[model samples]
Target: MKVSMQISFNLDIINKCVCHKCPVQNQSECVRTQMAGLKTSFREIPLNPHKIPKAYCLNGKSVCKGIDRSKPCICGSCEIYAKHQLSEAEPGGFYCIEGKSA
Candidate 1:
């Protein structure tokens, strides 16, 4: 069995929460930073809680439920991959497992 919850808060929204990669139209580096952050954040979570929150990570690594190759991966060509020492043979591709390409 599974359960879901939705929480929303309104506080004079200021800056638009756009991904850094989306800003200035730097899709490559933006994705790398976002992915790296997601991987690191998830790894920081403790396992004792036994509850993981969803909708947090947005590194663009997640695949569709039934799809094998969801989107074209640019990790191989990304600069972050080389800067951060991420490998292509890792289990989770993109930003999920190994994290950013930069």
Candidate 2:
């Protein structure tokens, strides 16, 4: 299931995202910096231009190498996840690793 960049980049979605709070996220400094950039001035930038781990629903796979795959995913709890009914999509949950919903 491919989601639009507009819907994925929506502030409401980003704000409600639980990726930053996930245990899988704590190991990556890149994720931290990317999260900070999104919170600061990069919020309006397209997900592809940010060079970050955000908006995986639209941006697909993460470039950051530090992520731990063993940790559980929190995408199931995300507002965007529910709003888009992502559970019906293939390779849905681990956007951080498996990439986008489809």
Candidate 3:
């Protein structure tokens, strides 16, 4: 049998994000810390609800194409990404674009 997966894209969580000042030294820990503070069920959605900062969202036309990937993506290790089944390739860097891990 094939395994099924649930995917979610929560703008509510994105809007409530507060990983800006986290000193966890990694995105995964930052996401874990942020999720610990939430009180919602965190259901799954189909779209990529994460938002990118206006400053870094400018890639001539796209919202995250201009980002410097060489800086290392913490999203891969982020708890939020794992919890929501989000991929880095879809949202790309969350720190510079999405205001951190939360």
Candidate 4:
């Protein structure tokens, strides 16, 4: 199960994720702090949801607090959304709080 979860969290998914730019987590100090450390993350190994707070839809709901859900979710425009056909999924796109794209 861990292997499958890790496999789901890949460099390709991370690179394509727009969570870093999303307004939902814009004010999250935790996300910002993690984002700062991401400069060397691509070259490093062993990534987890908290280690790299991206691709929430694929990696599951966020562990960080203070996510502003009042803002609109842009998951529909995401490559991961399209690739996964997330339009039909429940909660549509707010994967950050709604959990993975179920």
TM-score of each: 0.26, 0.76, 0.29, 0.83
Worst 10 residues of 2 by lDDT: 41-50
Which of the predicted structures, 1 or 4, would earn the higher TM-score when compared with the native?
4
Query: What are the clashing pairs of model 1?
Result: 21-30, 80-101, 80-102, 81-101, 81-102
TM-score sort, best first: 4, 2, 3, 1
Compared with the true structure, all predictions reach lDDT values of: 0.30, 0.71, 0.36, 0.76
lDDT of 2: 0.71
**Model 2: residue 62 alpha-carbon error in angstroms:** 1.1
Q: Supply candidate 4's per-residue lDDT for 21.
A: 86
User: Which regions of candidate 4 deviate over 4 angstroms?
Assistant: 1-7
C-alpha RMSD of candidate 4: 4.3
Task: Between candidates 2 and 3, name the one with more favorable TM-score.
Answer: 2
Pairs that collide, model 2 = none
Give the number of the best model, judged by lDDT: 4
Model 3: pairs clashing at backbone N, Cα or C within 3 Å? 8-45, 28-78
Which is the better candidate, 3 or 4, if ranked by TM-score?
A: 4
Segments in model 1 whose C-alpha atoms lie over 4 Å from true places: 1-70, 96-102
Question: Once superposed on the true structure, which residue ranges of model 3 sit more than 4 Å away at CA?
Answer: 1-5, 12-62, 84-102
Query: Over the stretch 1-102, how does candidate 1's per-residue lDDT look in tens digits?
Result: 121212221111101222222222233443344445654544553421111212211232322222223444344444433333345324323343333223
Q: RMSD, model 1, all Cα superposed?
A: 14.4
